[model samples]
Target: MKISEFVKQVNTTKDAVRHYEELDLLRPSWKNDVRYYSPKDVGDFHAIKEMQSVGFSLKDVQAIFNLKRTDGCGSEKLIQGFLDSLDKELEAVVKAEEELQQKKSKITNMILELKQL
Candidate 1:
């Protein structure tokens, strides 16, 4: 498919795909002036997006691709470290949200008491 169609199908912008291409994340099979993407390319594009959504930087994603290209596998230890860090961050976020909720409830009660006065 053409870049435009691929963008539409993937629900992404042309610039984003171009940026991915520039990062060597994904490339067209044929680069004879006009670019075309294959189904595999689309899958690779989705993988990049998914990784980004889950806190993987483009550089990290590129490293994964390089590893795969050269050795057919990414570093398990690196991926595990990311997962462990993400777990700790998620715990912190959840605790912060719970504290915020408690604070909100206290503020709401204060407002109600002032209204009653």
Candidate 2:
């Protein structure tokens, strides 16, 4: 389907489709300068969103995608790299959440003290 249609079907935005194209992460079938995403592109979009949810920057996600798509890399190696990246991202998110919780706790304590005053 066309980029717009794909975006609609996938419940994603056009900018996301364009950004993925820019990253070479979504190479749609092009005809007469118009781009049409196939089922593979849809699957890749889901993967990208999943990665982003896990805290991978677009650049990082693109790099992982490139690594996975690179002709020279073995499929097993690419899969391993992606899995490793996911692991690191998960760790980073956990750390960030912990820090956020600490900050929130401090703010809550401050609010309670002010209320007492």
Candidate 3:
């Protein structure tokens, strides 16, 4: 499909799609000066959004994509690398959760003190 149709199908803006194209994250073929996106490109867009939702930066997503393209999808090395990244992200999320819990506890105690005043 064309860019407009692809944008509507993906529920994203033209600029966003263009940006992804510029980043080499979305590969659209050009014919007669018009860009055309395929179903695979649509899948790529969803994969990009899903990764971002999980707190992966565009650079991180790019690296993951690159690994998949370089090594076959079923390559053990790619699986190991992705697993390592997931482990690191999980650690960061756990640490952030602990910090948020500490802050919540402090806020609850302060609220109780204010109620006693």
Candidate 4:
């Protein structure tokens, strides 16, 4: 079906379909200013939505898609990339938590000082 029909059936916007196509995630057939999608497009959409639902970034989706193209199967390189990203994210989370705790301590000290005045 055409992109419009596909969007209606899949509950997605036309722009979103185009964006995914641009990202090389979907390869809908194109002819005469119109695009048509098949089951593959639907699968791509589902894959993207599923990943996004689970908090995967667009870069992550693109990386996974690229890996699939190269490896034709799950690759250890992709797995390692994901692990590295996860580790970096975890480190950022820990740093943010430490910053939050420091701010809490500072605020508590100010409150105590004000209370004694």
Give TM-scores for every candidate, taking all chains together and pairing residue i with residue i: 0.65, 0.78, 0.95, 0.64
Q: Please list the C-alpha lDDT of all candidates, in the order they appear.
A: 0.83, 0.85, 0.91, 0.83
lDDT for position 7 in model 4: 92
At residue 6, give the lDDT of candidate 1. Answer: 94
Q: Top model by TM-score, which number?
A: 3
Local accuracy of candidate 1 as per-residue lDDT tens digits, 35-101:
9999988999898888778667788788777766665545676566557656765786799999999
Tens-digit per-residue lDDT, 1-117, candidate 3: 999999999999999999988888998999999999999999999999998887888888888888888998879988898888888888989999999999999999999999999
Q: Candidate 2: RMSD over Cα atoms? A: 2.6
- Candidate 2 positional error at 114, Å: 4.2
Cα error, residue 10 of model 1, in Å, equals: 0.4
lDDT of 2: 0.85
Candidate 3 residue spans exceeding 4 A from truth: none
* Candidate 4 C-alpha lDDT tens digits along 1-117: 997789988899989888888888888887897777898778889988987775678888898888877875468887777677667667877999999999999999999999999
Query: In model 3, what lDDT does residue 25 have?
Result: 94
- Identify the runs in model 1 with alpha carbons over 4 angstroms from their true place: 73-117
Tell me model 4's lDDT, rounded to 2 decimals: 0.83
Question: Best-fitting candidate, measured by lDDT?
Answer: 3
lDDT of 4 at 73: 47
> What is the total number of backbone clashes in candidate 3?
0
Better of 1 and 3 by TM-score: 3
Span of 10 residues, lowest total lDDT, candidate 2: 68-77
